[model samples]
Target: MGIVGYFLPMLICAAIPVQSLSRNAETALCQTQEMQGLCALSGKWRNQLQSEITITCKKGTIQGLYDSTVGNGAYDLVGKYLQVNETDYIVGWSVAYKNQHRDARSTASWTGVFYAAEDIIKTQWIRAAFKNPEDYWSTFTTNQDTFSRVQSHPCLHNNRN
Candidate 1:
C-alpha cells in the first residue's frame, strides 16, 4: 500500500483523541468548581433598570450565560453592572475560542446572562473592542455573527443520559 492508503486512516484516528483531550481540558477549566465562593450571585435575579436583562441565578450554581443583544451580553465581574429591581442576583458568563491553526478564523466571543426566577439563558455573539482598553466594558461588541467561528466548539457536558 502507498503512504496515503497506509497512513490516512491512522492519521484520522490519531486526531480524534487529541481533539477529545483538548475539549476535556476546556470544559474542566470552565467549570465553576474552580471559582467556588467567587460566584456571589448564586440566586435568581430580576432587572429593574431600563436595561434589557432579566437574570436568575440557580441556587449554588455558577453556569455561564449567552445573550444575543447588548454587546452579546458581554460582562465581567469587576466591570459589568446589573441593576436588580426584584429579589435575587445577576449571573453572567462568557465563552471564547482561540484558534491555534492559521488556516481557521477565530471566533470573537460568546456571552450570556441568566434570569433566575425566569430560568432564561440568553446567548449572543460579541467581537472584542479596543475603545477603552482599560475598562472591560469597552471591549464588548454586540455582534452576533462572531459565533460562527466557535459554533463547532465543544461543550463540557452532554445532556444525554
Candidate 2:
C-alpha cells in the first residue's frame, strides 16, 4: 500500500476519543515526577523545517502556536504520560490558521500526535484537504517532523524581515 493508504486508517482511529480515566487512575498514570519534565518541553522549539513552535502547558493540556515556511497556526493538544513504560503522547487539532491578511483562514483539519521525550517532540501529522467531502480521505499528505527545545533570544521575537 502507498503511504496514504497505510496511514489513513491510523489517522481515523486517532480521531476517536478514548475513555477518560478515573481520578486515582489518572494520578497514577500522570505522575508528578514524569510530568515535571514535560514543563521543560513547554518552551520554544525549532523544527528541522525551520518552524518555530511555542508550546504552553495548562491544566494537563498543551497549547501550541507555530510559524513555519508553509504558514502560521495554533492547535489545542491533550494527552497523558503513561508512566508504566515511560511513554508520552499528545494529540491535537488545528484550531486556526492565519493568512497573510491576518484573517482567519480555514484549512484542512490537522490531526497529529507528538511523541515526547526529554526535550524533543517527534511529530507526525496528516493534513487532509476536504474541499470535497466525498474525497477528503484520499487527499491526505503526511509530514514527519522533529522539534528540539532552544533557548529564546530577544531578536527571535522581532518579526522584522
Candidate 3:
C-alpha cells in the first residue's frame, strides 16, 4: 500500500477511539454524583431560620438569592468537583448584602459534600471574611450549614379521599 493509503486508514482508526473516549467522558460526567448534586440543588432551599435561598446551577457555577427577615442578598458561587470516593465539591461565594442595618458584603469559602441518598448539600463554611473591617467580628472561622431541598407546593395539603 502506498503511504497515503496506509496513513488514511491509520488516522481513521485513531479518530474512532478518540470519538469513543469523548463519548465515555461525557457519559461519566452525566452520571457523576457531583452533577447529580448540582441538578438536585438547582431548586429552592430553606434553612432553620426560615430563610429561603433560590439557587440556579450552570456550567459548574451557582447563582442564588438569599431572602430572610434579617437580610437579603444575592450570591455568585463557583464550584469545582473533587475526585473523592464520594461526591465532594469545594465552592466559594461572594454575597452582596442589601437592605440590612449595615450595608456590607462578605465572601465565604465552603466545602460541600453531596449526599445523594438524602438529596442534600451538606456544606461547611471553612472561612468567611467581611468587606468592611467593622464586621470582622462576624467572620466565621468554621460553621456548618445544611441546605435542605424545599418541597414544591408546600402549602398544598395532601388529603387522601
Better of 1 and 3 by lDDT: 3
- Worst lDDT window (10 residues) for model 1? 146-155
Given candidate 3, what's the lDDT at residue 31? 53
Report lDDT per candidate.
0.33, 0.46, 0.48
TM-score of 2: 0.49
What TM-score quantifies how close candidate 3 is to the native fold?
Answer: 0.49
Once fitted onto the true fold, the runs of candidate 1 whose alpha carbons sit more than 4 angstroms away are 1-96, 99-103, 127-161
lDDT for each residue of candidate 1 in 1-161, tens digit (9 for 90 to 100)? 78355333322322233255475564453353332222223222222222222121223333333222433342221113243544333333443422232211223543455344544434465565445446866665574321111111122132100
In candidate 2, what are the lDDT values of residues 18-69, reduced to their tens digit? Answer: 2344555434433433233233334466778787665544334444456665
Backbone clashes, each candidate = 17, 0, 0
TM-score against native, each model:
0.25, 0.49, 0.49
Ranking by lDDT: 3, 2, 1
Q: What local lDDT does model 2 show for residue 28?
A: 48
Off by over 4 Å in 2: 1-38, 72-95, 99-118, 133-138, 152-161
Write down the TM-score for model 1.
Answer: 0.25
